[model samples]
Target: MKKLKLIAVLVLFPLGLNLVGVWELQRSTDDHAEYAAYQADLAEFRPELQAIADNSGSRPVMVDVGDGEKMEVKMALSRVTEMQDELDTLLPLTNVMAWVAKGTITLGLLAALVGGLGLLALNWAGRRAMHSRDQLLHSFTRVTKLLPYVLVGHVVVMGAAIAAIVAFEALGAWHAGRLSAGEMKFMFFGMVLVAGCLYSIWQMGTQLRVMLNMFQPTPMDVMGEAVTVEQAPVLWAYVKDLALTLGALPPDHIVLGMAAGFYVTSGDIALAPANTTLTGRTLHVPLAYLGILDEAETTAVIGHELGHFAGADTEFSMRFVPIYHGIERSLVVIGQTLVDSEWLQRATLHPAFMLGAYFMESFDHAVMHWSRVRELEADAAGAQLAGNLAAASALVRISAIDPMLQERLVAHITQATRPTSEHVPVSDLPTTVLREIAALPLTLPEEEMATQLPHPSDTHPSNGERVASLKVSIDDAVRSGTRPLDATQACAAMDRYFAQPDVLRARLTDDYLSHHVQQDAVLVETLRTHAGNVTGDVALHEGARLRGQILIGFSGLLAVAGLILLLAPVLFPGAAGRDPQPFFVGAGIALFIMLCMLPFGVRLFRRAHKTALLLTPDHFVFANLKAPLPIRDIADFNLQVGNVVMLTILLEDNAPLPELTSRSFFAPDVALNKKKRWLMLPMSKFCRDDKKLKLPELAELIGNYVNAGAARHLLQQRSEQSGELKAG
Candidate 1:
């Protein structure tokens, strides 16, 4: 309890109390006049600027009158003041004198802080207990085998450091015959603490290194026989190519699973790394009951998995895997890297550090969800290398093939998300979700949402979006009459992403389903809620731009006020009581008013979300932004790529034009609402437009693209796999 109290004072209370104080302070000092001026100027319109907004998306507008009603400004100011207070309440105080006072309060607030810290630790341990992190642990343990070498290095370095420190201390005390006992005690204690920390780190590193497969060179194909396994002749051909790719991977290991097989640990390998192991791969094929995918499809799967291996993507992750694995293994086996990183050396150190480390580890788990998403990219790269036809089939087959594993995966997914709900009362969750949970769901947004950031903002494209991107890339290459480049080479090159093919099919059906085709109801609802917003925001943003013109016009009022102020001194010289302060104040107000008229800036988060949604209009006519994409711009296309389908509407008369992404593919009806605002389109309205594009016209357009030999070739293998009659 004392340790908990100390932690609360040092960490939790300071973050909380300081933020609350900041918010309260800001609340006390918000300015209202600025807001009213902003609003009133927005609603009022000018004829010259209004036309530009209507025709060109938005117009450069300015208000001629510097005089806005004072009452409106006052009310606006009042609201902003409250908002400021809310903001202040959330701040982590960095103001002068806060450090000492905050530090003092922190020492006392440790109990409250430690409570949440303890809660987080309990939740993390519970989660680890419940999940099959053992598979991951085993995988990491393989990495830990290398830890002994690392431990040796650390021990050598720290031993030398200790000896040097001791020697220096002895030299200083040589003249005194003997060191003061108290002074000697403090020095010994400090050195011992440092030594213990070094030992712990070395021990942990050694444990995790045991799990690492990369530290040792073990070929996946020990005998170097690529044709050892028997299969269909067509499948064999692609497998041969796959073997070559795998052979090139250092520490050569080749694994194949048509569905989900234990081949990773199966063929002459008792302890291959999880990366080399082939359990999950065969599960998809077998569980879905898919007849083996065709040559192209199979090739795609191999290429995709192979891409992950070749690129050393797994190595890229697990940078910290060894550290944690070492600690966990040591904790489980010997019970020592169990000491907290900061407090491990101090015999009297706070237990909260260990608890705090628990949350940090939990947070790492939360972020690891992105690794699954990253797998999707590997999937796409595999498709690209193996050929689109094979990849497309492979993806379709994957969803169908791995039922039990997918179910388990879905369960693990639920486990991962539980941390986000850590704060939710267990009583509130559905009985099923509650039962699966080990502890209360973590309610902290900062940790859960933190991982989501630096994702879309990063140069690495999202895994969810990669399939679409690859499709566009393929279409572009085909149109350009260039042979598709190698996936490895393509990664090293750059090009404007080409147009996407119109979707031929997108529906959900399974063992429990009654319908042949079903739209995602969630998507429909989402589209319904936000399609209106995308439109309204686009319109509102434009309106805001036009209204801001009025703000600029206030500058003219500033000029007039300045003129009035200067002229009043001479023109009203006889009026002894005339004050120039009023004119000058008016001019200042006009200048301030002008500044507010500029375009209302969109928040970065909102923009990022918009980018994620792919919401920017295909062609936008907004203030200072003009982008037009006509339906004639589409070329030979395919909208039937795995799990995605859409209508393609071209806007240009020219053949084989660069694509317009947002406009061409009509949102699949079911998904229209769920992702409507994200796509930033009134998709249904555009898709349903009778005058502009009736169903027959859309159909004819699709038929024309499908009929083209270039597009037809892509489906030659796909249509046959689906047993669907190929339309001429």
Candidate 2:
């Protein structure tokens, strides 16, 4: 709803510009009594000059005696002629200004009308298209293709408006007969707007290139080892039969990984760990879950994945995936790069780009709606392949069991990697997991069973929703466990399919654990180094101070520029000509802007002075802390890098903690949790010679003090894994 309101504002921005143009037109074209008198005198004096020129002898030429006073004909004629010359010069400039204003109003009206109506129609079409699969696919494809054109149109409209503004200023200076400081400043401003528009376009092009690159095939090594038909003949045979039964094409390739759930993809798969690529229709089956889910449950899960390949879903994906990634990249670029640009802000191009961005963003709700519908459709297909109850049971179990499995795996990895504990091989992880799954309660809690499954490829329906859609009770699904794992192999799927199930499990588990341990080692080292008392000037806060100073300088420049514009007409009377209203108005606006910005700049500057962060074994201190905050109460910390580099510190507030405040004008305090307080630390460059607190060092220090540094290790593992999509 907030996004909709923002889009409306953007769409109406051009109309607002039109209103300004209208006001300017009226102001420029207003009747001046002095100029009118000059015109009247010129009319009366022209014939008198002609008569005087025609006379053979010296004659006392009587001028217009409207006030009953006769003047010297030659002298009156000279004054009237001078006024006529001035009028000839000023009238053309005034006409040009009027024409420019009209043009601006016309263009602004068209842009506002077309942008608003077009987005509304598109939004309506998008909502209507959700009823049919083909329509849904077409709607998304059409919008994706139209996005580039919409952005281009935005640029063109903004460019034209800027051109109009520049033309008006240039012509105004030309009529003035000399360049004034005000004219030069406005011209410079117009140039900056053009530069910002061009830069923003270049950035969009760069992001588009990134989107195109995503289409190329990337490796699946990080996801898992590929399984050929020869290696898993039974599994291959089962999948082919399942695909045929579900009226879908079988996967071109199969990958076995230790991820939580199953998923299918037709796009290029990139492997994060190995930085490699794979191309083809791929089906990824979770190795850990294979031992946990029985035959019927496995059949239902596999059916659900294959259901995506049914009804031309994968075929649509071939077109949709690249566009989806492109939109994501574009939004990221707009938010992170273009949105923060000072040039764009000054030129007001930021609002234009945001308009385009939000138009694209508005489609997300529709996309999510249709995405959920697609999932539900696939769920129905899965139900058709297996019994509805069986499919429901599989969905419920997958959602419930995965978190439990992750907890066990993370716990084991955390303990095994500890400095005090002996190295423990994870070769028997499959057998251990199988035992744990068998030991799970016959019925899971409603909260756990009602949650959505963990799938990386798309948003999923909740377990209860899927079960209800399948016309089955949640309790029935929970109680309907799959048959036990084979006694010897400890996994039904492994027993039925692989010739060497134990060996494969051992290799995969060892590889997964080794990768995690290697990543954790670096974080563990950092934690150990920063586990003692430390004091240093926060680079984040220092960066904020520098930004504040820059802002102050910018505001000062604006104020100075405004003063110059306000005084330009007086200092250079000839350069201002007959009117000085434009200069005064421009000066007023600039001064107002300066006034508004100065306070924020000063606040940021003052608050960031001597800002230091102190970390100790027990607590940490930041800004003007009334008391040091307990390190043990530190819940988590996240470092965000972009236009503003910031570190967020979350502290548990259940117990009495220090009254902490940032007093930052830009990034204020945000409430993240009911019983927790959030502290924002703005950061930038750090001293690398172990002198100042680094962002990563700060996170590590907090992680070390919290939960015996186990979360620190877990955080590293999770960060890498979540950074890119895995098999799940």
Candidate 3:
């Protein structure tokens, strides 16, 4: 399906280019036909005029006026020769038009040919990558290398086609201008095409920059503390022995952290604690996981990580990871580019974006399959180190418990961040939390565990598939209860591995608490700001002010131009050559434009001067409306966040809303919709200083006010009912 879409885009772009050529040709053909008819009519009278002139020297010829009336017209033989010469010169213009049309059409055909051949080459490479399973690494490497060139080729071809079309169209327009005195109109269109071409170039440059940034060596965020060999000699020894047993290269750096899973990487890592970067191969041990898995299962997990370092997989990864990241980043940038572009720019850029996307998509598909295969091989290597049952058991335990553990951790953090929640003191907080999580019985159902697919990050296969490949039954591998290490054994292992386990755990806990404390502070601050906004005026975003200024300036320019156009021919009639029709037409257009634009500019200026949104105890007011909307009339308000943040206000049914025609710079973006009105402003745009504000925080604040209003209304109704009952 993806390939077909790609092909369709490729084919459609060239066809669209050809259509441009056809339109140009048709326009020129019409002009040529008109001229040809005029020239033929003139040719028929030439011989009679020549005969009259030769017989009578410089005689005035009698010509027919309208309705069979005769009129005398002066003529000379030299004047007749001059008129014929002018016609002779103009006749060759049609030939130039024909050549221009042919050239444009030829360019389109060439573009189509280039696009077709590029697709073929990519298809052929993809087939080789898919079928060459025996030489999988070689095949994947070849495809990876080929992909960049193919992508570049597609972009270049599309760019060249656009450039060519723009050139040919501009030439055609310039010629058309000679026939009709409308050069400015044609020039404006030409500028638009040129702008589109330039914007496409900018988009390509942005993608290239994103791709290039990937190659710059940057520290990978490990989000954990580093563990040196001196600090955890036993852990390091265990990893080295596991690597030796698997016949793989051992990691140079080790990190013990509270992340959900264990992993290994060849990239440089920046440890969360101590703010230090570690270079070369690194192995990360999730501290929480060690408490859950017994010694043998732990060994099996380590062995599996070592497997990635074995044979050709390590070499493949060294080459593949950078390309993978580059492609991912470029795709994200292009997608954002498309979103930010206007409709005309989108039309010009969509094809080029699609071609690049197709290449990335194809590469990802091939590499993902290869990754899955490599993971299976790693599982086999792990089984050799420990028994197949141990390997299978570790896989099942990790798959089932990791998700629940992550959820528990998030719940704990959420609890700690609440305003009213108090901190609990513990001697070793990290270890205590891990033990508690480990003691919780695994509730993951067998069916669900069997269905869990590989995470894209590591490409680890599902528990069911791994166990089946190892010839182990699901029942045998699944943990019956919390079969984790005893607390005493767990403490012993920690002591044996980490050098000062208690202090490290304490520091990690402090870091976690401190992070949550900052979050609580932010929440408090948002509440304070919301309280202020409820009582005070909320001003328009700076963008609104800028928009108002732009509108005013534009309107002023239009007015000046209109005045000039209207008075030009009137002030100097001789400039019009005694035919004032062109000047009249231009003045009429200018007058119409000024009439439309000036009023809109005034409205924007008035709105921009007023407050954008006014929040009060009882009512909400907008800049555009004279009357305020009572709080009771509003059902709800929400923040729709995307490329921009929009506050949508949903009104109660049949609520009285002011009728609006013109769009105000400071008013709601969509006021015509009866159900929902919105302020199309990003939160950041509201502040002069670049303060980062969250959507959910503002949403919550608004909800609080609305809910408070509802509570008051309910109490009032109850009081009224009580009074009525007493009276009865």
Candidate No. with top lDDT = 2
The residue ranges of model 3 lying beyond 4 angstroms of the native Cα positions read 1-5, 22-56, 61-103, 114-124, 132-184, 191-221, 267-280, 333-357, 363-368, 419-421, 425-427, 442-444, 451-456, 479-484, 512-728
Ranking by lDDT: 2, 3, 1
Residue 132, candidate 2: Cα error in Å is 1.8
lDDT of 1 by residue, 1-728 (tens): 64466445435544554454344334322322333344344444233334443564333333333476233333343444544443243222222123323333332244344444445444544455334434444433343353334323323333333333333333222221245777777666666765664576455454444323223322222111121223223333444567466542322333222113211111122211122332111201121111223345545655654554444454433233334433443333222323433343322122323433443354355336444544566566666666654554344333322343345334433332222323321221112222232122212221221122121111233322443545634333222222222322221121111111011000011111211012234433444443223221121111122233444455566657656665675778765255666656765676565445322222211221122111222222212212332212333332332322243333223433332334322111112222221112222212221133444554454343223322333334433533432221
lDDT of 2 by residue, 1-728 (tens): 64566455546677777886787677557733345566786787688676875682585766654588777777766766776877777776678778887887887787676677657756775676666657766776665556455545654565566566556555555432455788778777766765655565565554454333322223323457677787788889999999999888898878887764698877666653445566767888877676567677788889888888788676655556445654555455555655466653324445445544555555556667766877888888877877888788787667666777787777667555542323445576766666665676534676875577776657676767777888987667777743343434446555568777777777777767777778778876665555433343222234356657887999999999999999999999988888999999999999999999888787667655344555444556665566766666677777787865576777665646466455545432332333446776554533322244566775665455544433434554555654432322
**What is the lDDT, from 0 to 100, of the residue 529 in candidate 3?**
54
Clashing pairs in 3: none
Q: Write the per-residue lDDT of candidate 3 for residues 244-343, one digit (tens) a residue.
A: 8888999888877664367777766667656787876778888766667777888888888888889867775555553455455555666687799777
TM-score of structure candidate 1: 0.24
Worst 10 residues of 3 by lDDT: 683-692
RMSD of every prediction? 30.0, 12.6, 13.8
lDDT of each structure?
0.35, 0.65, 0.63
Whole-model lDDT for model 1 versus the true structure? 0.35
Which regions of candidate 1 fall more than 4 Å away from where they truly are?
A: 1-237, 243-292, 311-377, 389-393, 404-463, 472-728
Q: After superposition, how far is residue 523 of candidate 2 from its true place, in Å?
A: 5.8
